[model samples]
Target: MSSGIPYTWDTDCIRASATCRAEGRLGKGTKHHPLEIQSTTTKKVVYLSDSGSSSLHTVGERMDWKRLTLVFCWLECASAAGISCRNEQGQAVDWYILYKQPSINDENGLVYLYMDESTGGWVPAHNPIDDQKSALAQTLLPLFQHFTNETINFGYILYNDQPPEPFKTASSSFGHSKGLVMMDQETGIWLSHSTPHFPGFDITGFWPNSGYANGQTFICGTYKYSAFRNIAVQLQYIHVYSFDAYIPEYFYPELQCVVDKGCYPKKTPWDRQLNMTSLGGHSFISYAKYSRYHDDLYSGLLDKHLESAFYAKSWGRLLDPLPSNCSVDFSVYNVETVQLPTTEPYSITKDHSKWCVTMDSKLHRWTCIADMNREVSQEHRGGGAICTDNAAVWSAFLDIVNTYQPCQS
Candidate 1:
């Protein structure tokens, strides 16, 4: 009944024990040593060595071997609870980034590279998409648990232009964007991603293989509860897939639209632009363009601040339109090919990811990850981008621009 640091089993030892048990050799000989288990629930180290002894071990004589075994089983079940993306270690992280490579890479396109504070740059993830160890799984797993476990009280919204089927049929004039927001009383996370029909439907509780076909991107940031206010203002510009507010007492009036399953009914869809600082202190400017504004976000909204031409990718040529020419000073071009560091060049057609960067490096290092593309059909779509001036992030994205098609004068 006491609460403290949860017990963590040695993953290696656990695997070894499982293997022994499978081979029917566990506890067979004196040479087999007791499995070592550590409990951090107490202030001091409490070692429990399961050696198959008949004598009952006791903690303060009040808790016997039988009680300990039951407690251990409960702990195991609790630790195994939640969705795939829960923080397994229960450690707080500033932020994490994921880049899902296209299937063209030979491996399952679902495989992705992740970057965190511990990792200076991108590292190939060791776990698969479904594995709890994977960054995506750990980050998103909590959402599943929040819905399934009533004991977990939180608020969340899953919004995407193309939401999961059945639910997708219910919407009308939703924005062209994809993102998710989930939070408790203390802190929360806002995940901005570029995949559709993702994280699966409520009934399925699974990750869809359909999202793995083309390249995709996801940026997750942990933030204080106050940050959700700014996030709510921004979501007004995007589409809502499926939204549920468990703690209605904590809901803001603006956020209630999500709960109502309706878009704001305003003649002039309000477009907003603002600076957002993540819990990690990373600076990002959000450009939220509502559907009422019929213009390309890059050329009409961001070109002035960026002060340089851009190369963006939308859908393929069949649906793609001419690149937008800047009315002010710079132009926005269509990206034809994308080449990432240490990766082969690939056509934009193969990339469902939507992002762009300033062509000239001298202009304040700008890289943007947006939800909508430059296709003609998207001009009036509600969507936005999270842009950063960080040199490292900008350089990482800038270096991948292989070629672009300039707008005709």
Candidate 2:
């Protein structure tokens, strides 16, 4: 479809453009010609007034009207939809990552760490919910408003093993998955997270305080309509959610089972393996649990002869871990203390981040973020992981392994 407006700027110009866009006074420009303001005056100073207005002042100097106009257009579009994750052109992007840090010494509460290709690395978010410039808020605010905006015309499914209080008893066989999906005919996003009892009902605009007690992570990816077909496959493997909500009008035949039977049919043959490509150009492999493939993700991968190591919260079934076979080295990740590349050292417990890394230095490094733990009880449950071999993602996750408990022989 249309890529929207074409404008690019550095960090400083981006901030200024965001301000201009939020105020809604950016002049017009088209793809054929760049933005240009024909002014004879020399040095002109454009600044925002305390009342939040953009004003231009002329001095005895030359100024770049074309550059200024581009900035204005860029920021205007960026601010048009409120605070949202942005691309290099200061336009909204399709995917983003948000990490919630636990309340540590001197830290106030939940701190949001945001990242997109434009920003490259993680940046601290000023506000997670209301900040108009925040990627997380930008991506989520629309979904929150969808509850009241009937004309918005989008399809959504919100699932959590521990759902909001109203619909807790809906499904007991669902895997321990927490996520939400919102889409239309063209594009949409899938937000996979580790927080329980979250995004609260349409009425509650606040995050549950309990989520702040430990470290949590969320990954949101925007994808073309075609990608949802693969997503639907993954959801089928997840079985069901503790609580789920979907609109029948948006259901494709593949996903109609969710709306009709409350879950996929018991006998429906589904692919146990899938490769999902995100809009951001990231690739992930999803492994589903079914009939002969009853083994856990690590063991299943091991059976294929892929050697790897895993890191997960050890509270559930730490003692009954899968042994390290000749090809795979499975282990439990311990985080008594964590030192990450982007943040300071902090202690955490009950961290729900499920991920693993291949340890074979000779082989291509592989990293996977999953929805299930390594506990014995979870072996029987249906869940999956999205794996990638991106080095940056690998480095970011690898640096956090302070210690691990190796599997017994």
Candidate with best lDDT = 1
Please list the residue runs of candidate 1 whose C-alpha ends up more than 4 Å from where it truly belongs after superposition.
1-58, 61-91, 169-172, 201-205, 243-247, 263-269, 324-328
Give a tens-digit lDDT track for model 1, residues 26-98: 1111112322333334211134334423222233444444544443432333343322123323334677667
Expressed as tens digits, the lDDT of each residue in 1-409 for candidate 2 is 1133333222233354443333333344334433333223233344443344443434545545555554454445444443233433345675666666665663544666766655555667766432344454446555555565542446677777777666663354666677777676666777777777776654344366566655677777777667777687677777647355555465565555543435553664432677777666767666666322455655554224334444543222255755443343454343345555445675545355666666545565666666666656667666666666666566566676665555445
For candidate 1, the per-residue lDDT at 52 reads: 28
Clashing pairs in 2: 17-75, 21-76, 42-61, 43-61, 43-62, 83-132, 83-138, 84-138, 85-135
The C-alpha stretches of model 2 lying farther than 4 A from their native spots are 1-91, 105-108, 118-122, 128-134, 169-171, 201-206, 242-244, 248-251, 265-271, 290-293, 301-337, 342-348
Candidate with top TM-score is 1
TM-score of 2: 0.71
What lDDT does candidate 2 reach at residue 396? 62
